[model samples]
Target: MLNFGNMHNSVWIGVDIGTTGVRAIAYQKNGVNLCDSNEFYPLETPYPDWAEQNPEIIYKATEKVIRDTANTLIYKGIPVSGIAISTVMHSFAPANEKRELLSNMITWADSRSVEIVNELKKDIKLTRNFYEKTCCPVHACYPFLKILWLKKTFPDVFSKMKYIYSLKDYVFEKLTNKWVIDKSSASASGLYNAHKMDWDEDILSFADIRKEQLPPVVSTTYSQKLTPDAAQRLNLPKGLPVVIGATDGVLVNVGIGAVKPGQLSATIGTSGAIRMLTKNPKVDKKNRTWCYNLTDDMWVAGGAINNGGIIMRWMRDKICHYNSRRLDDIDIDPYDLMTLKASKIPAGAEGLLLLPFFTGERAPYWNSELRGMFFGLSLNHSRSHMIRAAMEGICFSLNCVLTALKDFGKIEDIRVSGSFTKSTLWLQIISDIFGENITLPQNSEGAAFGAAVLGFIASGEMNSISDTANLIQSKKIYYPQKENFLTYKELFDIYNNLYQKLQPEFTRITTYQNQMYK
Candidate 1:
């Protein structure tokens, strides 16, 4: 129970429906964090490359956090002005006319529709047409392809589905009994026309669905009141205005105050993305990046990598099992210990290179068949060398996205957020690899803070979104080291060449694995 009694008279609550958990943060108008609460939910992978979650569990988790945070604030007599929501993008769940979920929510990481994506890629005309309209490429992660996958494999469920909704839309329906989605979430679906701000009839026809099956698109700052039942269950005041925030990825830009033209924001959480704000939709000629709306006039153009801090979790569980488990006894956090061990190794990991595609990949190369590989292992290498290489590999993957982002706008500096900022070593690694200065904001709550900013704007506390950059403060700045940048520049070439050289093998391996399963 945190006290907010002496804090600023005005406070706003922001709820983030993240991939790993649900978090609610209470923030003052000046961007100070009053209190926060979080609850984790299980992510199920019943088969390989298939990620799913129960909508009911997610809704319950959302309810618990909101209740916990709101009650704490109210107990302290802090008047909460409004509530806002931010959620993960590209999540799909089918529901009946009554709004009853007909299937588990399919997340962005799920690759069950990979084959359909590949098939669409073979038809350049169709793929390019959709990409030109939606600003999202033909990928298994997009709901457009996912709908085709459902119709082909689960026709019974597909036929029964009266509407398709993203995770945020489903949660909104649970809270307000409304079927409206924000423009940012709709833009990521590969079904919405960015220019028109509506569902694309052509794409819908390709997926064998109609426009009526999707929620109506609304602005990111759209607001609705919480229903009476929802208000009572969450211990909130009836008719509390709920501001509809944008997708977490887009809102992260707002949260970090990266609304300027040349400033890029990178978030390295379970997955990672590098985005820049633009006045107009910026579509890549090569169709490698996604352009999603933050508002009617503003769009976030960037690429996302499916693997980020998740690879570190894998190393802890499988490779450093003993060391990680014993960290508690040594009074050291496991990740800190891991970083400490890796620091002993020299830069470039002493000639070892790791391509971290453990969970396939995204951005630059949307190849789901690509697997993780350590390309330059030697007999002299130790576990520490592998750990250092893993860290470098993750940065290298993000650098690839940064390279693609240059086509849209010039990146002057990077404002970074996410759990990875906990490690100074990781921060320096990203700085050196990108050859740019990295700034960490004082309020590193990311999307949750962005949602609060939206609430402030909606409640007339803040003048505009750009005004938040002046309100938020920066904590630290990490500059790139010239020597390390040179080393990474050389290694990055090998990193790119390794992927190209291994592309054929990746496809062959996928073929063999499929035959074996058959």
Candidate 2:
């Protein structure tokens, strides 16, 4: 093993295996990010609404990031002490006895099993009992429904499976030669009991899966040394301690140091999330807000919206004409310039409100057939006006979720993070719509940073998880303007009514589409 004494100071690493790529980042104990590396991998969509990643390709890319990072550290004469892994949640795949992936990793974005989700939701005995135990709703994102789809459709693959693992567990197994998962991730799987910290036998029986098919669940601080093979591949010392990490979403909240109660977190990346931590496990009776464990005693209550930045990308490619006029070498990304142009327009976008259900609604409405619309538009509306309205509509969609937390569960103030916070205009919109001040953390490295902090705590360098939160400093805060609060309240009410009014029409369109596919 490389001697740790030669290092300048304690160096920790965090590996975030995301939907698009793998990122390996190194940080110091004081929350300063030193260096980072990233590698992209393609996502496969064999059929409509089916998103899968070749687990082997993802693993190889992850190996490359670590190896390249280690090489960079060696060039700089920096020694690595530890590493941890965090990933997107609820996706699962089958693995053989040798820890090789036997099937494509089913990502959370996949909707191939929507039919199964609909059927399960109709089963009160199954849905009620499962939610009571697991604290998760029966949705297409849940592994239990995915397993059902696999068994009913691909019986041969299901019968030959030795074990089923979430993407998080698969990565951990690759590093440590051990198959185990932490509570934060397990709770999101729909097969785990968030309150009890164990797999729900009732849900497992419903899925017809056994304990042996899943990894053992452990605390977030559980530590294991890396195996010789993994060490060689990553160019790190063998037997280096690696800490079990939480889900990227949970850790993103932590990374921004938003651990205090009522400090809500909103992240907009591949998708959007609005979450906050609470002491007790509380689920929204209507199942609008999802409740999952973040720690042994802490629970996260929030909602995930299916449409986020992806909508902006769609507008950029399929709708925006201004971006087409620019030359290739202008050094301008259409996305940033579009946001800049949208910022110039006034609030409310001149009575225009966009329903950002381009990909269908996930939370609050839960309507799969909902279509996007531009409401209250006039002939005077410009592309900038439409773009600004779309951004506002996205914020309003998030506000719909935040309002639910306040009205349903009585959650208070929220802290915001992710790349979207950099936009002063967007943050102000969020603040005004929610009618609460939004705090932006000084360190927005997010999930990767949170994983490194967990490693630091596991190594006995930090006394408590809160230590990371304390180190965070706020760079800016967005407080709502009282004058516009009433306008937003009226617009939000209209926003809620739009879904109810359009549900029947949406159902008809979806029925036609399904018939066509059939």
The model with the greatest lDDT is: 1
TM-score of each: 0.95, 0.92
Residue-wise C-alpha lDDT for candidate 1, range 3-63, written one tens digit per residue: 2222346687999898889899998877788888999887786556778999889989999
Separate clash counts for every candidate: 0, 2
In candidate 2 the C-alpha lDDT for residue 293 amounts to 75
Task: Report how far off residue 336 is in candidate 2 (Å).
Answer: 1.2
Mind giving the per-residue lDDT tens digits that candidate 2 earns over 1-518? Answer: 32333234878888887777788888888888778899988767655456788888888998898888888888898888888778888788976666566789898777667777777778777687677778777777778778888988888888877899888777788788878999988888889987678998877887888988899999887778889999988899998888888888888777888777667788876668888777887777777777887667677778887777777777887778646557346977787788888888877888889999766666766555666889998998988898888888888888777767875445555677766776788788888888888888887668888888788777777766677768888888888998667778888889878877888887676567656756
Those runs of model 1 whose alpha carbons end farther than 4 Å from true positions after fitting are 1-8, 322-330, 514-518
Top TM-score prediction, candidate number? 1
Candidate 2 accuracy as TM-score: 0.92
lDDT scores for all predictions?
0.86, 0.79
Tally clashes: model 1: 0
